[model samples]
Target: MLKLRKLNAYYGTSHIIHDLDLDVRKGEIFCILGRNGVGKTTLLRSLLGIDTRTRGSIELDGVDISEAPTYKRAQFGIGYVPQGREIVPGLNVLENILLGCNARSDGRRDVPPLVWTLFPFLKEHLTRRGTNLSGGQQQQLAIARALATDPRVLVLDEPTEGIQPNVVADIEKAIVSLNRDHGLTVILVEQKIRFARTAAQRFVILEKGRVAAAGAAAELSNELVRKHMSL
Candidate 1:
């Protein structure tokens, strides 16, 4: 239930996302696929009102949020797990997760039950420092923290990038479960084509900051990957 129209994003006059138009339906996983430097991360930042400056319309459930601040967007039901995970270095696992509660409209500090259910490991290590965890564990912690916001739309940028192969599968499975079983809308910026094809209901391939190809997951063919995403 998110829509973007004519979205142009910039980082200090270096234009990134260019007049992009996209739609993410309710309770579905929508993948954004592109090679490095194609503005995938910039687009996510634009949606979240992060560093990049943006122009045009961003609508969440029919209400315009183009001018809303990052926290306001989060309060409006967009949860972000950034590209690097960006786990707060000094915070314990529980404390890091509780940080997301600041975005909650209700202003509750309690972590949602869903976060524990999806990542039971987090519960056991609630006292552990977030930065002390493994890469995959930190990624899980990031996702768990985002879930603590109780967002209607989960926006993840490269959730499995550089993750251990064993843990990558777990991350993929969690994303699928979140969309299919938990009824959450996911906007995923993913590098892994195989996982994207299997988990996403629809996808768009970006080139030079704009949609080059977009269709159902089944249409993410070998030819398309070779054309838009091959190194």
Candidate 2:
């Protein structure tokens, strides 16, 4: 449902991403992988129109969105959960989730019961302050907040960055549910190889701001991983 072509981005004259092109098919999880500082985040920013210095075409479905603002992109069904799980520290869990409703067109809003059913811990912590929750809980909150928007496509940047194994398992299960059960399109930008295997149906590896490798996830071999992502 998302497509980008010949994408170029600059950060104050330091050209970071160049000539990037990829597509996230509807009802599939497509991953963009690269080492640190290789412009994965820049690509995500370009898609969201967060980088004013970007040059290229970004489209949701068939509509051009290169010049669209961040809110407009969100309105176009691009829900983003950034790398850091940027939840409000002072807001209670329910309050934090309510902010996601701003992306919706209708005034009447509701969080899907499945959201709480998936993360029952959040139900108990509804009135609890965000700052009081542990890191994993905060990560769950971030995902919940994005899901609260009920977007057609979900863009998640490094969802497992600092999460523990069990929590990561839960998040992965949630993603699978969203994909297979709900048919949400996903654009996952991540560096974790093991986790990458779990979510990605196709792979696009970026290096020095360009696509160096891409294919069916099942086709990614040990040699490819070694050359492109090994530390």
Candidate 3:
């Protein structure tokens, strides 16, 4: 559902991603794996039009969105849960989620039934300040906020980072359910190799701002992991 060709991304003149080309198929969990400082997050930001300097083609469902503004891209069906789960601290849970509805064409603000289904606790704490929640709860809120956009493709950057172990499983299951049961296309930048192997249908290992190894998840062999991802 998403394709990038010869994509290059930069941050204020410091080049990061270099001629990166990738494809994320519909209804599939596409995992991007790499050690720190390898441009994984830059790639996701570039896709969302958050990076100020980018070149080449970014297409979603056959239409080019390379030059679209960030809000326009979101309106075109790209929902982003950024690396830090950047929820507004001052907003209550409900208000934070409602921010995503700005991307919808109808501009409707009602919380979708799916959000409550995925995060039952959020329904009970709609009035609570977003910054008051636990880390995992905050992450769940972030995902719910993104889902509020009704996106065709979800871009998640390190969704499991710093999450509690027990809550991590819940997040993982929700991601799988979103893809398998709901048919949402997922592009996940993940550090947990075990979860990546189990949840992703295909994987790409990034090295020095470009893809070094990529294939069916089963083919992400130990040797490749050691060579490209090991500390």
Candidate 4:
């Protein structure tokens, strides 16, 4: 569903991602794994047009989106839940989710039933200020907001980062359900090796802004993990 070829990204004058190539098939969870500073987040940002500059090709569902603006890309069915879960601090939970409706072609603003199904807690607290929620709750709210976009491809950057352990499992299950049951195409940048192994069909390990090793998830052996990911 998504492909990148010879992609390079820069922040200001300093390049971060170098000649990177990747592919994510429809209805599959494609995980990106790497140590810090390997351009994992940069890659996601480039795909969404958030980086300072980018070169080469970015295609989604066979359509080239390399030159599209960020909003246009979102309207093209790319829902991004950025690494920090950048929920608006002032908006209520419901309002925050509704923000994603800006990308909807149908012009509807109601929260999708799927969000309520994935996170029942959010439905009950629609009036609560988004910033008042716990980190994990905030993360769920972030995902809910993205789901409100009615996207064909969900781009998640570290959905489980800095959450409580119990909530991490909940987030993981939600991600799995989104991909396995709902058939949403996913491009995930994840640090949790166990979840990546269990949930992803394929993965790419990045090193110094380029792909070092990539293959079926089952092939992400312990030795490979130690060599590339262990700090």
Q: What are the per-residue Cα lDDT tens digits for candidate 3 across 22-45?
A: 999989999999999999999999
Q: Please identify model 1 stretches exceeding 4 Å from their true place.
A: none
**Which of the two candidates, 2 or 4, achieves a greater TM-score against the reference?**
4
What is the C-alpha local distance difference test score of candidate 1? Answer: 0.95
Clashing residue pairs in candidate 4 (N, C-alpha, C atoms within 3 angstroms): none
The worst-scoring run of ten residues by lDDT in candidate 1 lies at 111-120
Candidate 2: lDDT of 128?
Answer: 98
Clashing pairs in 2: none
RMSD of each: 0.6, 1.2, 0.7, 0.7
Query: Going through the candidates in order, what is the number of backbone clashes in each?
Result: 0, 0, 0, 0
- C-alpha-based local distance difference test score of model 4: 0.94
Q: Residue 197 of candidate 1: its Cα lDDT? A: 91
lDDT of 3: 0.94
lDDT of 1 at 192: 88
The CA lDDT of each predicted structure is: 0.95, 0.84, 0.94, 0.94
